[model samples]
Target: MLANGNVLHPRAGRAYVLRGGRIVVSADEIRNADILVGVDGRIARIGEGVSDPGADIVDISGRLVVSGLVDAHQHLDKTGVLRFTPNPSGTLQGAREAFAKYARNAPPDDITRRAERTMARCLSRGTTAIRSHVNVDKDAGFNGIEALSALRDSWADRLTLQLVAFMTPHPGQDLEWLEANIDAAVEKADVVGGTPAVAEDPFRYMDILFGAAARHGKPVDLHLDEHLNPQRPLFDAVFDRVRKFGLEGRTVLSHVSVLSAMPRDAFERVRNEILELDLGVVTLPAANLYLQGRDADMLPPRGLTRVAELVRAGVPIATASDNIQDPFVPTGAGDMLEIGRWTLLAGHLRGDELKTVYSMMTDIPARLMGLGADYGLREGAFADLLVTDCADVDTLVAGGADAMTVIAKGKPVFDTASRPVAGDEHRQPAGSG
Candidate 1:
């Protein structure tokens, strides 16, 4: 397909040949290969010399073609509400208060409009998959679910959207309301999730979520310990319930910022439990950094978990943007690269862990969402990929890439020219220090 390495961007929409690119099958595997996408929305073949005379061919030489990025921890229901409901204090409680007030009056159509814009931003920037948490309570009822569910069905062809019924509790909306309406929410969502740190009894909060997941046979994802105080740790409940509900492989923990401040023994205990349970860990730094550690007078603590240690321990950890232009974060464009870079900074990860960092945005998160089996660049995998303008993983994650030519399920959706500015670019040969 790539004659003499002749380069050309894919122009055909449905089925085509992505010829000659550095195909990143995983964090550690990179191959210069050609990909043939069949009309059935799966990759027909991928090899060094793949070709097809009958199909359209687009040579992507000198570029990096990898699996589409995944944002596994996002609040889609509360996205794009920064202007409508501003969190002037920029604290966790402030965001909760502001959004809770806004949710009471926000209409379903309005939620749909905001979420649709957010999804478009994510898709154009090469995030072809997302697991968004929708707030579910008596106050909002199923409005958030209603909006995201419709969009999920419509965007099924272009993006893989997994909805989590986030059992939420605010000032006016308490735990009772959330418990009462979780069933309806879980029925509409792909996962069962909640923030146990907010509940009066953290154990009770976790039990409710795990019980619901067990009853419905759904995966569980909970926002845990999103604060800076070491004494406020709530991971014990999560570790116990994973075994109690037999949700070891089906459970995911998000925003475990307390791990950063925990004592060594406590940290090791949690880490051991995580490894024992075969759990999925998602560290969301975007909103954590924005909303946590407000009371610090001197050098503030970075609101992130022990990412480097957890990664070194072989834990299935992923990172994502928890909020986008919402009361919680106030600034974000649904860029997974930006989120990855932030994870490295806030989590104090080393430069040699670039591949692992890249995985946090792609394969690791895909695995956390239970899409790992068919998520990456393989012969029979879905052709959900992005032909990015980067020489390698370091250049791409270091912000040296431009717009992405996204292809989802063998179909070229749109070639967008805009992406998030992930600080400064850092490119030094692939294997260099």
Candidate 2:
């Protein structure tokens, strides 16, 4: 560790020291200190009264410095599918129609451009890492994976983008072909993804999905329960498969919206199994609230994954922005903060509870994505960090927090006030007015 005062010369990447910021050293230690970003893109040093004379120092007085946010479940390709209104029926018809339109019409170049814009937007909103799920059925095939893979490579330095290849059922598709496709994706990407609950036989299809993922040595991300009145046994089946394959940290179950309606015992059982398996949970509260409760009777369910109980029980959980304008949820514009805000409101996490909700977008989610070392603002961690206008965690949700600066690997990747565009007078002043 090359250290000078708080000045760190990380091994081989880049180095920039930040001074006088309220440094969050891990999730618990918040102190006034300076940070040294090393050459290998990790934090080289963090201490009080740093005195680096020659190093470049960024003054961050009166601001809060924290780890950049991580969006664990996102559909970057769906941003282009914002043409139509949401389906009122909330049936498979809507999901199929939207998927068809995307399959046929989503141009690769358009996806890359929009995905870039979405990434920039996410960074501007403090998200430094994202796991984007790309559709890769027979329709798009390698084209979808290629586009997303290219985006991942292009944005590697500025932001971390992990691609998940989505597997959907097709007519007469060979099982070996499915395995091959998933293998190709895992070779090129991060995780193997599927929506097994939408399959003709959800349980059997899960066996295929998880088995393939296990074979490829990649994680499994299943779109578990996106609808209300969901088959509660499905989660248990998923956990069983995870245990069977010894894919504990290598599995993620997203959008389990039906858990709010499950009986207490069922919830307890799933929660216990989830903790035992050490599987990650990604709750898309924004999309879930939008899609569910369409046909509710006396009491409409919250439509969120079980967040409080899971967190209280030591189960790792993350929140996500699932869609931009697809048929499932039409409101997202790739904003993880919106998901965080909705999670705070819908999950009833407030005050000190807000800390956990905030971590759902940052530390917890990063750990869920297996990027923990590159996530936090600790020594030897990646220099990737978020500087926020919000003084504390509570205001991060209350004020639509803007990332004053996003440093990726010690290089400044985003700054809200650096570039002043002409005819852009509509921007509000810093902090909520």
Number of the predicted model whose lDDT against the real structure is largest:
1
Encode model 2's per-residue lDDT on 54-156: one tens digit a residue.
5555556556788877889888866655664346566445665556556666678877887788888877677778898887776667667788889888888
What lDDT score is found at residue 240 in candidate 2?
Answer: 79
Candidate 2 least-lDDT 10 residues:
424-433
Model 2's C-alpha root-mean-square deviation from the true structure amounts to 5.6
lDDT of each: 0.82, 0.72
Superposed by TM-score, candidate 1 places the C-alpha of residue 218 at a distance from the truth, in angstroms, of: 0.5
TM-score of each: 0.92, 0.87
Which candidate has the highest TM-score of all? 1
Clashes of each: 0, 5
Clashing pairs in 2: 10-38, 10-39, 10-40, 11-40, 13-39
Distance from true location, Cα of 327 in model 2, Å = 2.5
User: For residues 1-433, what per-residue lDDT tens digits would candidate 1 score against the true structure?
Assistant: 3444443444444466776678887777788888888878889898888877667667666567889889998888899888888778889989888888888888999989989999988887788899999888766778899999999999888889999998886655566766777787899999999888887766777778888899999999988888878987877767778888899888888888898889988899999999989999999888788777888998888877888999999999999988888888888988888888888888889888778899898878888899865678877878888877676787788764665678877777767564445643542222100
